[model samples]
Target chain A: MSTRRLIPGSAELRAEFPILAREVHKRPLIYLDNAATSQKPAPVIAKLVECYERWNANVHRGVHKLSEEATEHYEGARAKIARHIGASDPAEIVFTRGATEAINLVAQTFGRTRLAAGDEVLITALEHHSNIVPWQMICRERGAVLKVVPITDAGDLVAGAFESLLTPRTRLAAFTWVSNALGTVNPVVEMTALARARGITTLVDACQAVPHFALNVRSLDADFLVFSGHKVYGPNGSGVLHGKRALLESLPPWQGGGDMIASVTFEESTWNHVPHKFEAGTPDYPATVALATALDWLSALGWDAVAAHEHTLLAAAEEALGAIQGVRLIGTPAHRSGVLSFTLDGVHPHDLGTVLDRMGVAIRAGHHCAQPVMDRLGVPATARASFSVFNTLEDVAALAAAVRETKRLFGA
Target chain B: MNDLDDLYQEMILGHARQPRNFGALAPCDRSAKGHNPLCGDRVTVYLRMDGERVREIQFDGAGCAICTASASLMTDGVKGLARPAIERVFQDVHELATGKSDGSKDLGKLAVFSGVSAFPMRVKCATLPWHTLLAALDSTSAPVTTE
Candidate 1:
């Protein structure tokens, strides 16, 4: 296929997702909440159907042709994801339920074995609870301290405070490559490099980054990296966890079940090798293949063009929202992804969100499961809109138009 | 602009604009902070009762019009009623808002929030203050669950 742009045009982009074909309160649906979860494209849905129709079987234990084919497809998905992220070895990648589970696996297995009392783990203010809560649980259990790196008012990480927090006792530094709440694309390459010099484990929750930007874990120097499949137009209940070979080899198995054991006995049992060791039970066979197909499609649309398309939407939205009176945009960092969070002076976010929904413009309006970030911003809640490659300038305009109508209705 | 078509009614806007009995009471006997995590609706209910008679009730917080108006009306609903009667009123208001109990419902201007139940997502916004007032009657730290 020729390297044509994903945004054939605003109308063309709007036609891809069949969900957008539906009406909301008799108005056209303008979904702008990609940050929460994106609508799956037709190709991704077709891939799901194809997996069930042709390649459906239990993987890795049967010598039958069907099982062999299913195993091959599952492993093929692993390879596709590994290649997409520039992962050096396919064995470095492990299939997980989603990014949340992948992060939990590291915290449970690695944290249980590698860390102990007085050891500290550093996380940032920008993390979703998925990243923060798991580490907090592990730290509390293992008698380790959890340190939080603050962020500037502009939504940029307070680099100086982060540097100051680093100590010899610090065992790991986990942060998002791009924040899901605020769109700040954290400089993980610099962050990982700094941690490595101090012999600290560097973890990157790249669920938000892998969807919108090009990434190479080797270049970023991340000891562990994770991204979810659903957010990238793949099927749900699938994710990828990439870890350095030596590090994965050292950690113990997280769950005990089928496909993770080499041999089992009444008394003793042995575990499977690296990637297989982490993947327990019957894996999500069809969803895994679809995730790989989605990644393949994203690869075909080169990151540069994809990034440019998303930037266009973000620029359009920022300019339009700024022009409206009493509208304040949160997370105005110089470097950000396409997510936009904002508040109007007199309108409650709940009421504002309700108005937006009735107008067929869907945006997230709440704490977004990141209450800490909300507290930091001094807002009880704010309405949020996130963009993706499929979105266009027109969608941003719909959001602005909806906000203005809300202001008018509320007499703000 | 009379737009009942808007999610908020005039009573809701009025309460939000000039909230009656708004602000913290003087060293209240019972107080509890109730927060709706989803919408960030928060209300602190302060009550001072004399024996079985309700003396005073006040509240303060950041919330949507539904919650603010509900808080404002809640004070009026239980001001003259006794303790047992107040509890019954709580039940009656809950039943009325949820469409269980109708005629003779002493909901007052809270009747405006009857439209809110249609939007399931906004239900908590209307009930946040009621939950806070429930807590303020007699409770300790840590949020008390209504559902």
Candidate 2:
């Protein structure tokens, strides 16, 4: 794997991320927490500043020039996001606070309206809390049952589980495209096809997937998909919910406010169009424009190059970190990406995290918001070091050394 | 790594490895569970009260080194004290862990955790046990959470 050939501009690209040069605790920072949130590049940050400095105004209401410019940039962002994911129409993209809000919108509107008593909402054990909890709330409220498709010990979905789970009573199937905790890439396209065959509406939580590869929602055939901006090296409070045009049009408005209405009376109100009906209040226009900048920057890198770079780092991390004594790798999926989760002998993940932090090697040490996954793995928690395009072989070496130091400190 | 050394002294690590009064107290009078949802660290403090004084105290659950060591030191620190005296010690320990005051005056063996003040995010780990103990004393049914 010649990373230089895979990404010829890798050095220049790495320089674009300013925070990579920062030092934490008097040592140069080795930021391996990309799964939680990715560091923003210079273009994305500059776009945010430009939005605030040049055209900072509410969209769709005012006829002033600033509002018009803001609206163009905001709507332009929607089109860019839709095209990035290969959605058929820009109207399918709904701006959200983040993936959590995006999932909740579908649950509150579509799930609330469509589900009936005795119906089942199928999710997988690999889902983040954002993907699981909304469905749980909707299921409990509608007297619907929540079904979980279990994963194998290696963290992959059990073979034939999706086909078997999709029965007549299963109203919708929601699952993650990648496991944030274990970095296990689910067979989402196949799963979605199975659900569609059984007339089940499918939603893919692509928060972890979008950063690592290109996704085509049309080819995927999932009725809905979601991702957060911050996880994609974009600004926080920016997210996207991509739905099939007809499916989004069929759903009722999730929230009621000024921009979402067509005609309002004290007695009754008529709603706006598909995407606008879902976006109730003033959207985060600046963040949305910056998110578009992030997508453009990422797309310019070419998904193949990004994937190749990250894959190399992830493989190096696995080998280096695994070589240390008593360091147990948690997930060994056939198609893993970007994340390496592990636990050390006689040392808790939190303790490992603290020692690593002292050495400026930042990693996540928790259940990773997948408590059921933690329960299935039969561990309290695991330390996770997720990668990005900016990470290098040296970062992996730093992580390995930090783990060794942590072991020595604990006398493991 | 001065701060790291301060945070994980040999005493703290030893207590974490072999907790003094671990496991549930059978025939216990009062008990409460403490949870730090941030890291999924959990502990249940159990007390066998002899009228106004604590006759025996034990705790059982899984947590990080700081949490387990803090619980171990806490049980050992408050075993013989009466309810009022235990509450006073809790206040002092809380102040010491938060870096409001040094424990040189009265914290005794519990002063091993004075190093925790340097790591603000870990204050909850060192104090979750004390909170559960307070909850047990108050006979609260809800599990104490260090958010």
Candidate 3:
């Protein structure tokens, strides 16, 4: 089962990312840090340059030619995001800095407006710090409690615990579709449906999921779905926050600035509609346009091919690394995606990461901004090797060899 | 293996595996916690000073190999050094790790960190314990942070 299989277009995909061709520490770079941020493809990079070179102007308010082109591309990107996520209306997709800001927008606006004293915001232990901290901030401000659903030792969410945690006071529920640190793919569709049945608002952090698989927000029935562009082969500081039209109309605006106001007199200002109300100021138009190109690029590749390719990498890494003496893989969730974290018995993750780096293999070695998960797992940190479209079997071999070297260094 | 060996010398690994003076000191005169928030490495330096000399120096914490090894070597190196000498050692280690100066003969076992100069990122890991020792000596309660 661990035998390597060729992924069609895999070579072409690898060639598209220029960074992969370079060497680190005099060794060819074997990038296993995709969960942190994916290396951008050639088309995505070109799209960014095209947006700046061809249509560089402030969006929404200019009558000039460049402005019109910029506004056209900006709104066009929003439409592309809406279509990609299966949202019927483009007006529902709000642009933000990234997934963090998108989650913060919902927490501050929807959360602050709807939640009251004694209310609870339910989250999962698998959530990234972005998903966890925003709810904590909003809950604290609204005099609401923040509750967490527990996960098993295998990093799977405890299904029974989730139902018990959901109460009449659970005003909202937010969770990651795919855990960044642990590779656990949460039961997002079922969890969203459960929350919907109880009339609790739901938000899904698809930062990790969007890169590995195709997503349709409508089928998931989440009130809000967010993912960063950088994670999905797009430019940095660009993301989509897909909210239900009715829910967005109900919530108050997050930021007050030029583009978000319909009319501003000296005293009172009328807020703009849904997306514009949330997206204040002149946005990063180049990044927005480049994000659309990234979606198109992935759509061209198709999910079947992408998913199959990533699975092979994950499976091979699991088999190769598990065979190493004294190496303990962190999570074996029944369903997982994108990441593989592990600990070597005698070598600290930092040492492993440093050694791996010397061998031209890059991996994350820390809590991965999810301290709660670390606290639960009883480890300070784990060395993580995350897969992406560009990763191949050679990369996995390099990773396995590096782990063996690390073990040898520690005399295991 | 050229520069990497320098950073993780056999001596450094030995010190990390069996850190010297690794435990809390009871009724310690001066103690300060050190934190490297980026990697969640924490160390608490305890000093029992005898007038101008460090009578006892010990550390208790969890950290990466570089940090643990540095702390172990630091405690073992500075146990009998006076304040002025400890200050000089700190400067020498700093210079050695940053490649600003050659390994002074005085650095001794601590010279094992001279390879750390090649890996700029790990310099903090080797110096955090030393700074925490300074904080303890200064009698400050604020945790020393190596950002």
Candidate 4:
């Protein structure tokens, strides 16, 4: 196959990810499972080391120099993350374990306090289990009903469904900007606007969108937005929850611990501030700083370039894989990003995943924690190959080849 | 890293393609369902025990190649065996699939599952049928899950 230059400085950009050079099963590794989690770039890895080597101390409490420096870098990371998502104030950004925790934090604090019996929480069918289960728990506890917006057969959200679900009883509307299972990019801006106009709060799960889109919380007008660090080429245990300052201040603290307290007595303890009160315990300072480094590295590459490169790869994969007989692409949304889910006619996804592993092509093959989407598509699971900025046309070709080999092996 | 052929032997693939006893057993005396939530594999084992002697056994489910084949082979291997003999064969097959015991001990036609030991992640897929069968024999009401 001839090498195609899709992204400028493509080779250099690939070189920045050291793991891309390694071999699996004596063949070159084609890591296509970006939706599961991304491979960390060299600078992001180095930032973790730099944080541990230079400023190894707990943040925010101690008067020592190390603590002060650690606190500065930690807070600096919050500010960078805020800016990356176009938030005006750093105080609005609260660090959580990952997108799962971020959503749960909002559900426990906001959903628990604001929602009353007979109130409704609206969600789409495209949500991952993390987004679904937390609201279910909170809704069950508060006697609130959980309303689901269905999707069309093409994996797009059913047209006009969001507006219909926004009744007076609907207190919150949480949805994903991009579907991880099918790569369906929802109309988050319009949906958020619709909910906002009806005086209902909105939460956007941008875990799959942050790497591919230049998000602006101010323009999107979501009351809360969240994304995971590991999914965006950063360390695990780091994530951001950006809520409007007034909205966050209105909700009470979910968890009580050492750092979130302003003052303590035998009878009473005052909360510290907006973000800190939500943070609760000691934060993962190094991982937070490294997450900021990842954002900086991605920003230097430019979001438009990254989106273009990934789109090229996804389109190439769709064309190549779709041409093969018995290879059924799961979602045909008008707009998609990064993820491509498919299933072969005779072979199950688990068997296909095992065969692809032998060929050194890593793809996610399962329900993808979105069983409802699988049920909607009328399949038990699918083999999903998600793309990233470092992925190339060559990788798409490799995926197609591996899939063909799988079909041959299975006599399908 | 064993070759794919080691796992997907012709016999296993054949059974997976067209599973034997692959439907609900009518007027079954005992039955149990097995589920592997991680991969969404589900199997139901039905048994018609005739006074603890030779009897009929069958299974039906939706599973992967390994799981479907394993269940198919299990029904064929365990049918007509007494309670004691079925228990012994179950131990042997479990040991063979987990690599605790080599195929040197005769597992009859069940020895085809020996290849499953190499793929540690797939062991559950290979053994879901056996677990369900055991649950059916014990008449356990709760469904067996390989979590």
Candidate 5:
């Protein structure tokens, strides 16, 4: 097959990720699971190793030189993440374990404070379990109902469903910028704007979106936005929650710990500033620095090139897989990212995934933590192949070939 | 195909395509549900007990080849057996599926599951039905999870 170039420098960029060069099952790895967690590049890995070897110290409280440098690096990551998400103030960025924790932090603090009995929290059917369960927990505790906006069979959010559900009892609307299971890029800007017009707060789960393109949370005007570091080729346990500073300041702290406190007595205590109060404990300093390095790398690549390369991979895979005799593509939303979830006739997703693994094509299979979407689509699970900047047309071809092989094994 | 032949053997595939006892039993005396949330595999085992013996046993659900086939084989292996006899078969099958023991001669057709121990992640799939059987025997309603 002839190689097709989408981005000018993407070929060279692929070399930056060392893991891409390795072999799996005696064949060169065709890493297509980027939507799950991207493989880290050399610079991001180097930054993590450098942090531990050069300056390993706790942040915010230590008086020594190593402590001051560690504090600088950690806070610098906070600033870099703030700018990456288009937040105006660094104080609005709070580091959490990942996107799940970020959403839970908002649900526990903001959801607890604002929501009252009979209030409603709205989300779409396209949500991952992380986006759904946290609100379910908070709403259950607060006597609030959880309302779901319907989606069309094409996996697009239903037009007017958002507005129809935006009743007076609706206190908050939290939804994903992109569906992890379906790859449907949601119209979050219009959804957030509609919710804001109705005086309801909004939070956007950009965990799938932030990796593919540049996101301007301020431009979207959502009260809160979140993304995971690992999904963007950074270290695990690194994530950022960006909130409007005024909104964050008014919400009470969720978890109490050493760093989140400004003053403490036996009977009385005062909380720290907005970000620190939400952070609660000692943060993963090295991972945060590596996350910033990842942002710097993506910023250098620019969103245009990243999206172009990924779209080429997605389009190629879609065409090739859709042409196969028994392959049924799960979602073909009008607007989508690089995720492709599909099923082969007579082949269970687990069986397909096992066969693909032997061919050195790593893909995700199962409900993808979006059982509602799977139920809506009338499937138990799907085999999903998500593309990233480093993925090429060859990778898509390999995936299509492996899928064909899976069909053959099932005598299809 | 050669690499996965051990996992999706012809016998397993045949059973998956046509699983035995793949329906709910009416007048079922005991029943329990088993679910593997990771893969969305769910099975509800129903048993009709005549005193301490199982008169009829069946399972109804959706799962991968290994899971469905295992449940099919399990009902065939344990039906009409007394409580203690079924318990003994369960122990032998568990050991075989988990690589703890080679096939016992008494286990008869259940020896096909010995290949399951090679794939660690799949061991749970092969044993989910057996666990659900135990749950049914104990008359517990809580769903078992192979996390």
Candidate 6:
């Protein structure tokens, strides 16, 4: 099926984007590296422009109209995001630079309060370095132990590994909802459910999942969910952290700065309420506004339509890529989103990427910030083409075409 | 600039597949590991020095074509050269490849990599072996590692 009109569904609107409307390398830009970052739609760009042009005031302190407007828009964006992720109250959401910082915030703050010297932190084999490193940093500082839950040969987190790793000393479990490297849609719901049953707090890095699928925090039963806005067609510096209010309230404010504290004195200072306590300095107000607009754009596209279109593209990609000799797909789970990571014989991924770039096709080729995932999959690096709402079956053909070209060039 | 021929010049690919003096020297003297985390390029260079001269040079690892081919050329060029002369070879390679050494150096097979410096990202892949050469010379019995 010709999916050019289906994926982004922006036939009526995408022309408004000055960037996408132009030609790249004399060809229509087919952006398949959505996992690296998705291009912002026109509405998000407009929202960014609106924030800078009209409501250009620092939030939370002023009584004047512009300040009030700025604060309202800022907090309103939070509410929109809260609603987007099935959060009951805006207080449950905190703004972060991106999911990496959000994850670090939890690891540093919550890990400090809940974990002891001997406590163990559980993370899966497929987590991004962002998810893995912060906890390692906190553990190294606090003398707590870090335990990795291994994955199966097929790249699923070995279900039993977590059970054995979960001791009474286990403090928290954090892992990705869907792996960025292997495109493995982890059974995080079942895994998180199990973690919670063992009295271990669970954190899910939903950066890859939330942008592609509908998310209900209650259904996932995760204590904390983190995702970046940029991956969801929003601004780069904005991200969301959805936590249970009780869990959020119990942790100390992560970064000491303005907005996070209600009052400060030389003698003693008390913290602000739940969300703001974590939102330290002046937030990325423009990016946050743009994030809400991106959400609105996605919602208007509708999940059922987006999922249907993506499934078509992904299936075609799998079949076409499988037909090529020496092409190995990383995650082969029955359930997956549209992210595909593969390796071709006798061609370095960077060489493959450079050849594809020459043809005006873009794909991510590297360790994908998941070296451990690369290690698990027994590949040095991979070339990945991730689909967003804007991608089409044509993008799949583009990927296959690029691989064929790469094979020809590499004498494979 | 010279057609993508600058990238896959026959010499570059030929050396990449059949790297000279590759594998390990028997009962090695000094060796080091060079790692490129960006592309996961790794190589262990083996050197056996007869007094101040490098009598034998060898390498074994997995890396991109540029790294492997450059390394292969490097071992061939440095054999029988004194430590100071080998150091001169390092400078000459850097000059020819990085556009620093007056551009008149007849690098033979190494000039195939000069186009790599133009790409910027591949410069390290081309220079990794030479960088490991310095580290291997100093780091005692344990292999010196460079990134």
Alpha-carbon local distance difference test for all models? 0.84, 0.92, 0.89, 0.91, 0.89, 0.83
Instruction: Write model 1 residue lDDT over B49-82, tens digit each, in one string.
Output: 7865668989998888777887888887778667
Residue runs of model 4 more than 4 Å from their true location after superposition? A1-9, B52-54, B82-87
TM-score of candidate 2 against the unseen true structure: 0.98
lDDT of 4 at A220: 94
Counting only residues 3 or more apart in sequence or on different chains, how many pairs clash (N, Cα, C under 3 Å) in candidate 2?
0
User: What is candidate 6's lDDT per residue for B19-81, written digit by digit as tens?
Assistant: 898898778888888878777778888889988788889999877778889899999888888
> Residues A1-412, candidate 3, lDDT per residue (tens digit)?
1124324337856777888889898889998998999898888899898988899999998899999999999999999989988899999999999999999999988888899999999999998999999898988899999999998999999868877888999999998999999999988899999999999999999999998888898899999999999999899999999999999999889989989999999999999987899889999989989999888877777689999988998999999999998999998899989999999998889889999999999999989989899889989889999998888898899899999998887786
Can you give the lDDT of residue A267 in candidate 3?
A: 91
Which model scores highest in DockQ? 2
lDDT tens digits, residues A1-412, model 2?
A: 1133224126777778899788999999889999999999898999999999999999999999999999999999999888899986999999999999999999999899999999999999999999999999999999999999999999999999878888899999999999999999999999999999888999999999999999999899999999999999999999999998899999999999989999999999999998999999999999999998888888777788888888889889899988999999998999998799999999999999999999999999999999999999988999999999888888899999999999999899
lDDT of 2 at A310: 88
Model 3 lDDT at residue A174: 93
Q: Give the winner by TM-score.
A: 2
Candidate 1 deviant stretches above 4 angstroms: A1-5, A8-10, B1-6, B82-84, B99-106, B145-147
The local lDDT score (0 to 100) that residue A356 gets in candidate 4 is 92
Model 5 residue pairs with clashes? none
- The true-versus-predicted C-alpha distance at residue A153 of model 6, in Å, is 2.1
A211-310: candidate 4 lDDT, tens digit per residue: 8878899999999999999999999999999999999999999899989999999999999888999988789999999999988888777678887778
Q: After best superposition, candidate 2 residue B30: deviation in angstroms?
A: 1.3
- DockQ each candidate and list the results: 0.59, 0.92, 0.74, 0.67, 0.70, 0.47
DockQ of 3: 0.74
Report the backbone clash tally of model 4: 0
Q: 4 or 5: which has the higher DockQ? A: 5
Chain B of candidate 4 achieves a TM-score of 0.93
> What's each prediction's TM-score?
0.95, 0.98, 0.96, 0.96, 0.96, 0.93
Candidate 3: docking tier = medium
Q: Tell me how far the alpha carbon of residue B140 in candidate 6 is from the true structure, in angstroms, after superposition.
A: 8.1
| Model 3 chain B: lowest-lDDT 10 consecutive positions | B102-111
TM-score of 3: 0.96
Which of the CAPRI classes, incorrect, acceptable, medium or high, describes model 4?
Answer: medium
